[model samples]
Target: MGRKKVLAVIHTVAYGKRLLEVLSLLEADFRLQVVFTAPPHAFGDDVPAFLARLGSVVLPWAQATRMTFDLALAAGPRGVQYIDAPLITLPHGANYLKRVTEGPNAGVAGLRRQDLLPGGRLPAAVVVPHHAELRELARDCPEALPLAHVTGDPVHDRITASLPLRAAYRRALGLDEGQKLVVAVSTWGADSSFGRFDALLPRLIGELPAPRYRTALLVHPNVWAGHGAYQVRSWLARCGQLGIGIMPPEADWRSVLIAADWIIGDHGSVSLYGTLTGAPMLLATSSEREINPSSPAAALAAHAPTLSPTHPLVDQLDYAAQEYRPEEYAAIGSRITSEPGRFNRNMRKLMYGLLGMGQPAHEPVTVPLPEPLPLNAWAPGHGEVSA
Candidate 1:
């Protein structure tokens, strides 16, 4: 039989990367087609450019909308109006990253919280990262539940799977045997570590002992697009001149995480995911203290030590290396990482079920398909599904 044609739509680099990784698992069974939507906001202009660096096939939106396919997949809501096929939403930022302290505007300050569906844009299947996320979706957009599937973030599957590639990645970076690797990750905005560090490369070179420590950078794609790639590249070149290793925007962050001994970052998913590695994380912003007490960002901030330019970097690193506890970060890990073999299986089950194909090879998960709940179950005085 011919493979099913699947249209994968992406608008942001983060969503693009996560959806790409998940789609890779279905390669043998699906004939994948990709479409890149125009950037919707200020930082978006860099998305297609960033996707190009990753060697992705980005169809023009005009052409993408005209194409026909059996299944459509996306990580963002922007795809809702474009694809005619049964839409599947594999949301990009499963962990909430945002200005939670900022009242209504507190929804993921950097990127749109793609998981929350609008009143009328429910997809055929919305794959969420965890049960808490599913609960969050139900509370906010229960209309999407009938189509929701509680599969852990597919990116976590890629991250856990990349653990074995660490040594190879280190070698590719030409690391010496004994040097401790410190990766400073900068997400976009003035609040992030990249923005906080005026002379980031120099500060890192000065604070971190060279013979014993090596520093690398993973700047967010939005930063590149926002600041202009030429300026970002020029800065990276300056960093390279100072003997700092830098990961290009296109580099898989999981690879960097696997090689990192410590991570210094601001409020973003990189920091959120870094916590899962049990590495002592130093946050560059104090804004995290203002995040909603019940929000995931606040949960992460409970453990991350705030970093300041004047703080003693080496002393903190040493203390963290010795005192870091994996158990403290386990809650975060549980939310992101799935049961080892469950992600692909659940994806296959969902796909096959949607396509009217036969049963998938994987066994059923412990949680049964969720029943549509009353709005009162989560919030008082709200109505049921909007349709």
Candidate 2:
């Protein structure tokens, strides 16, 4: 045989990023031929720009499906069902917690019967973060049970590995010593954090003491894709001018989550991940049916305090901090990944096993996230400047 071939499918900004995290494990292997395809998605913005920076030529979707590969990897189900190769479906976020709010396939986010076990056909494998997800899969798509594997969460692993670098990450963001970072995080759709507390963005500037607090935003990549980056940035321009810096979708958000002292978010994956920061989190919004009640995101929502607009935002932030106990967040954080640091190893082993290839000889390494860039460094666009 010449060499094994692999195809990476980019379904959306979120799915693309998750694929890269897992693909990083196979990067050093020269025996593999890998190419990527940006599949059509409702939110496909920035995917081409993201893939272009890697200096790899991306195969167009139509051409990609025509070619054969040893294995295909996808974080979303968008175009993977058509690929003529063994496929692995990875999680784009925490535990497939979000329910699909619309469309015919709309049901549980990840366990859509038509998507995973289309016409009673199963993907080669479906990798979930925890065993709890297996129960979810059983309830939703029992046909996928045997195909499911709990290799743990790579995103969680990266953050767990990078926790000690918190101080350095904070400094990289240009935070003054006394300033506590408050991150406003939101997932896309009408039930997200910004969807509810959008007015709170402007309020952050007026409510909190500037010297003691630094505000930033971590908006879901899909939101940026749905609303053009220019428009998203423009909408929040005034808030940006006041103080809050927006974390670009492509930036290593784990670093920002690491640096945060408070997390004001909804039931998004980031809030679930925020548990690791030991940063007290306040849910900016909550909808009865937006998330699975048993999912980790729900566990977090059930425990974390809701942000009350009637109360002073600062007082809520203060109360969350003063009443904070590591054990509480730690319990929620534990639900994220049962295998923790084993993600890289387990994933590598599973991929190599499927590819029928041998593992590399070198010791495994988890690269620490690089320092974050300043807000001004990634200005949404370079407006015309006077010479």
Candidate 3:
């Protein structure tokens, strides 16, 4: 019998990377076709060529393709209308932060209403990151519960697999022995944690004490959208001059996440994902100004230290480093990511069962990963590694 045809639609780099990671493992079961509903500029130049090497026939949403697909995968609501087949909504990020306090249908998830489904039934299943996600989906869209599956995220699987390489990652980033690293991640917008860093950076750089503490800035892709990549890189260059490292938008932020001693960021999923590493976390309380303070990010912050520009940044980091709690971090990480090692098997089950292809005995494949997309990294005169 011929392999099933599946259409995978992607927009953001996060979604593209996760879906591709899983699909790359299922190359033997499915004849894959890809469509990028997002603008070409939103992606790096390497994407198309990378997909081509995987034997994917990239299709433009407007272009007519006579081939029929048995199933379709989309990371967001925007990609839903662009594909034709039984749809599966596999989210790009775990929406745990905004939903807990604001309810399930807040932030990026509000658009993914059950009624939006074609014929209100095409999405045979909704692949979620964890049990918390399933609960949120049930509270927000109960009708879609039967279709939901807690399969976790492929990225989480990849992140878990990369845990043993911590030393190698730190080495690649050029960290000297005993040098403590702090990674501050921003999720975009003027209200994001990254925005608060402009004034805070000087104070942090002045107080953190050079030879002992090293810092890195990770900006979200939406920031690149608001202020083009070049402009964002230029703005980040100033931070680099102060002996801070800049994490390029196109490169995987996980590299920094695994190596950092403590993380300082906003309510973005990256903050939640950081908990998985069991690292000490300090969230920028400024994020609560725009987003709800009672949200999951705030809830997770209850477990970590909170940072505000008005507060003593250095003192807080020292305190958090000393009094970090592993149990609390593990509890939060469990809620955001489920079945870490078994994600691939769960994904295979969901896809095969939903597609009515019957369960096939499948094993994970080791594919050669490409180099990081060519993004301009900021390297000031200081001795800092370029991400």
- My TM-score estimates for the predictions, one after another, are 0.81, 0.94, 0.81
Q: Write the per-residue lDDT of candidate 2 for residues 266-382, one digit (tens) a residue.
A: 888888889988898888887667887777787788888888878999999999999888998898899988888888888888888888878998755777777777644545422
The candidates, ranked best first by lDDT, are: 2, 3, 1
User: lDDT of candidate 1?
Assistant: 0.62
Candidate 2 vs candidate 3: the TM-score winner is: 2
- Give all candidates' CA lDDT scores: 0.62, 0.81, 0.63
Task: Summarize candidate 1's per-residue lDDT along 1-387 as a digit string, tens digits.
Answer: 465667766666666666766665554444434444543656566566555654656667777678766777776675465566777876566454454444554443222244445335557887766666555555556676677677766556555555666667566556679878888887676667787667556668787877788787777767866787678768667666766765555445566676788988766677777866657877766354434344456777767676655667888777767777788776766656444437777787787667667754545432211122211122111212110
Worst 10 residues of 2 by lDDT: 378-387
- How far is 15's C-alpha from truth in model 3 (Å)? 2.4
lDDT of 3 at 311: 64
Name the top TM-score candidate.
2
